[model samples]
Target: MIPLQRPPLPEELVERMSARGERLPQYRGGARELWRDSRTIRRELSAHLVAMAAGLSRCMYCGDSEGTSIDHFQPIAMAPQRAFDWLNHLWACAYCNSNQKRDLYPMDRDGLALLIDPTADEPADHLDLVLATGAYRPRTAKGSETIRIFGLDRPVLERGRAQAYVRCRSMLRDLARLAEHAERAEAGAVAHALTVQPFADVLYEMLRLRTAPRAALVFGAETVAGLNMLKDPRALRGPLHN
Candidate 1:
């Protein structure tokens, strides 16, 4: 999972959502019914979410598979009042939304939610990714709950992430070579490739660990050099910063 930026919705849409939330009868059934009936709200909101999602509308939790549902970060069963609240909404895959998470919302003793909200939290802070294995190691309770709730450690996802890591490293090497040869256009293309792939967390983690204690040993000298090349704003600013 990666940190997401929640763009401001259109003023009209915001007003509509607020009005709908206010009219919801403070019941789970009411929230469900309203969400199901309001086709326009669902359509417009989902479009914006898809536009912001990584790699062709990938799931916000798993970062794999198409995100086809609107998931409430705080479940409607627990917080019906936030059913239409923009901040509570997230784009998710059908598996993560319906099969894994459902309406479960575990909380700590202080009443804070246990699950990690990708938009509000930096996932790397709570979870560490093993690039070679594609497994997530939980560094905090929130990370543990997120993995459990999303089934992020499933074999297929692990395999996919590991594959993505290999591909991203190769692309980075190509990017570094392109940069060395003063091929700015080709370098930009390679950088864009890194951003548009599935399991974007792989590339993100590689970049994050570029300066770690044993980065050279983990990423290899060529990949480490490639990562260093990315430090120049001209290298990845266009694709990554956008």
Candidate 2:
């Protein structure tokens, strides 16, 4: 997962939600019932789609699967006050939203959340990727908790991530060959392969390797960022690695 900027909600949707928030006390179970309303679902759908687009169409929690639903960073049952708050919403896949996270919200002694909210914090601060296994290991308490809650170490996700890493490594190897021959056209094709989504975390790691001994020697010591992805290979890493 990576830190993401919250997208803007439509002005009218914001106003409508604000009005609904104000009327929560009038509802049967306050914000609990509000979360079940069709109007609320409509507005949330809009926001979820916007967040998905902003997040490269990936789940905000795992950063792997397509974001298929709106998730409350603080579950509605636990934090009614934030039920309609834009900042409390996130784009998530079914696995993260329904199966793993559910209504579980663990906190610290001081009442701070242990789960990493990608919108509020950089996931790199908390988590580390095991490149060989394609599994995330926690660098901090929040990272560990987020991984546990979201099942970040699940076998399916691990396999998917491993495949992504293989793709990224394959691209780097091709770029290395292309560099030897100065094959600009083939290099450009290899670069395009790196940008294809689903597991950008893998590509990101491959890019970072430009500064590392082996990859740097393969690409060149003086790595150009954007241009290298197109003309060579450099930069990429793993929390989404820092």
Candidate 3:
């Protein structure tokens, strides 16, 4: 998961949610009923907005499947107070929302959410990609629970991520070869092309090997060398860095 900027809710929408919260009972059914009448829900749940916020490509959770529905980060069943809160909404695939993560929200001792908020945090902090198996390894308790709750290591997802990793690695190797004879400008163009691929996280993790602590141990020498090669001629710089 990557860090996403949470969009602000309009004042009118916030007021509507506040009013709904004031009158709604703290129960699943009541939360459902309250949201059914919410204008904010009506507006925000539109197809285009959901698609845009959901990255218009893949599921936020698995980052592989097509994102098809809106998910309540704080399920309405557990937190009726946030039933219509825009901040609690997320874009998800049908499988992740209905099949894997149906209303199962674990919490910490402080009552804070244990589930990773893809929009609020960098998932790489808690999770790591195992390129060999195409499975995710938990780096923290939150990551472990998220993997379990979302079935992130299910065979289908594992296969998909593995395929993506292969494609990402192939692209990196291609870029490295091209950088040898290509001008700095040409190498930059190659890196830009890499970003447009599906499962861009694979490319990102390899790039992060440059700065992340113990990155060589985490990602290995070849991965670090590939990224360093790209950075040598400034080929693999982020858009902002470039």
lDDT of all the models against the reference? 0.87, 0.70, 0.70
Query: Roughly what TM-score does model 3 have, to 2 decimal places?
Result: 0.74
The sequence of per-residue lDDT tens digits that candidate 1 reaches over residues 122-163 is 998999999988999999999999999999999999999999
Clashes of each: 0, 9, 0
> Which residue pairs in candidate 3 have backbone atoms (N, alpha carbon, C) closer than 3 angstroms, thus clashing?
none
TM-scores for candidates 1 onward, in order: 0.93, 0.78, 0.74
Comparison by lDDT, 1 against 3, better one: 1
lDDT of 2 by residue, 108-182 (tens): 999999999877897778988766678998999988999999999889888988887766666666765675577
Q: Who wins the TM-score comparison?
A: 1
List candidate 3 segments past 4 Å from native: 19-29, 37-55, 176-193, 211-242
> In angstroms, how far off is 121's CA in candidate 3?
2.7
Question: Candidate 2 lDDT (Cα, whole model)?
Answer: 0.70
Give candidate 1 misplaced runs (Cα > 4 Å). 26-29
Candidate 3 structure quality by residue, lDDT tens digits, 1-242: 55555766668766766777787765455877767766555555545334444234567787767777668898988987777667788778889999999999999899988789977888889999776677789999899999999998899878876787777666555666666666546656766665555455555566665577886676555556556765564444445121
- Kindly state the number of residue pairs that clash in model 1: 0
